[model samples]
Target: MRLKVDFHDQTETLTPEQIVLIENLLNKAAEIEGIEEGSEVSVSFVNNDEIQEINREYRNIDKPTDVISFALNEQDEDELAVIGEGIPNLLGDIIISIPKTIEQADSYGHSFERELGFLAVHGILHLLGYDHMTEEDEKIMFSRQEEILAAYGLKR
Candidate 1:
């Protein structure tokens, strides 16, 4: 699968190495999840204030979140249709808060890279229709996240 990840670092906080790492991890994740060729996803890095504004506007939550995902293809059965055969699948956006990631890494006692990878994978999973709204779903989603992270050698 040719997974195209468009990264927008609004905060300009990610290094080249970090960008490469995220690219590799997200590609592996797309392959494992059977995303078709030319599938596209956008990842954006923002500050706490920007993310908090997004959170409040989108989720109606006032606090800044570490990561937030907007999936484009969560369609009901009746709404599903084949746009085209050769068209790229637009997965959606993964918005990450740089400051929140740093704080979470410190709080979780893990590397910033690890936390970043986790959030990226988590966002991708959401794009693939995974949710943790229930206990069983949480188990499935969290376990998959850990497994993917471990497979990519970003183990906690």
Candidate 2:
């Protein structure tokens, strides 16, 4: 399935190659998850300050986070579908902190691209309804993340 990933770089620091990597990584992840073709997801890059403000406002947290995801299609199993035929599913928005990506990459002793790839996949999985509130859930979600990232050649 072809997933359309729209990116808005608030930090404007991503190289063309980084953008392409994110797009390709997300598409690969979608394909692995069996997401339908034409589904749309948006990813935005911001600085620590902006991400902190967003985290404060949305999540009641005052600190900056590495990434944040806003899922658009979250629904219960019995919820009725409102989307029409041929309409691409509006998956969600993912916001990443450029500074955080750099910091985390350095802290983890990995490449910047690897950290970015990990954040993008983590956000997309959140949009896909994967959560890590519990140990078991974290294991499930994180393993899936590792599987996708390894398949995309981003390992650490």
Candidate 3:
């Protein structure tokens, strides 16, 4: 698939290798989700303060989150129509808190790369209409996340 990833590193937390790893993981995620070719996804790395502001503004949660997704296609009929017309599918934006990622990695006893990949996959799944709001949905979404991570060699 023609997956176009636009990466914005507001925080210089990722090395070149880690950046490449994230892109590869996201591409694999799109493939697994059966996303159409020529789709586009945006990934942004930000600090805790920036993410906390975004979290509060968008989700009204007054706290920093590890990741946040803004799905462009969800509930947007015009966007869906463009996607159906062979245009590049604008999947959505995935904003990640680099500091939060590091904290979670240490707390969870995993590599930063693994945690980053997990968050990226999680955000992408959300862009693809996956949610963990209910128990059954949580089971399905978490299982898929693990499977995708393992396949991409980012196992926990």
Off by over 4 Å in 2: 76-80
Worst 10 residues of 3 by lDDT: 76-85
Candidate 1, residues 89-147: lDDT per residue as tens digits? 89999999999989999999999999999999999999999999999999999999998
RMSD to true structure for each model, in Å = 1.3, 1.6, 1.8
TM-scores of the candidates in the order shown: 0.95, 0.95, 0.93
In candidate 1, stretches whose alpha carbon ends up further than 4 angstroms from where it belongs are 76-82
Q: Number of clashing pairs, model 3?
A: 0
**What's the TM for model 1?**
0.95
The TM-score between candidate 2 and the true structure equals 0.95
lDDT of 1: 0.92
Q: What is the C-alpha lDDT of each candidate?
A: 0.92, 0.95, 0.91
lDDT of 2 by residue, 30-123 (tens): 9999999999999999999999999999999999999999998887899987788887899999999999999999999999999999999999
Give the CA lDDT, 0 to 100, for residue 22 in model 1.
Answer: 93
Model 2 — which ten-residue stretch has the worst lDDT?
A: 79-88
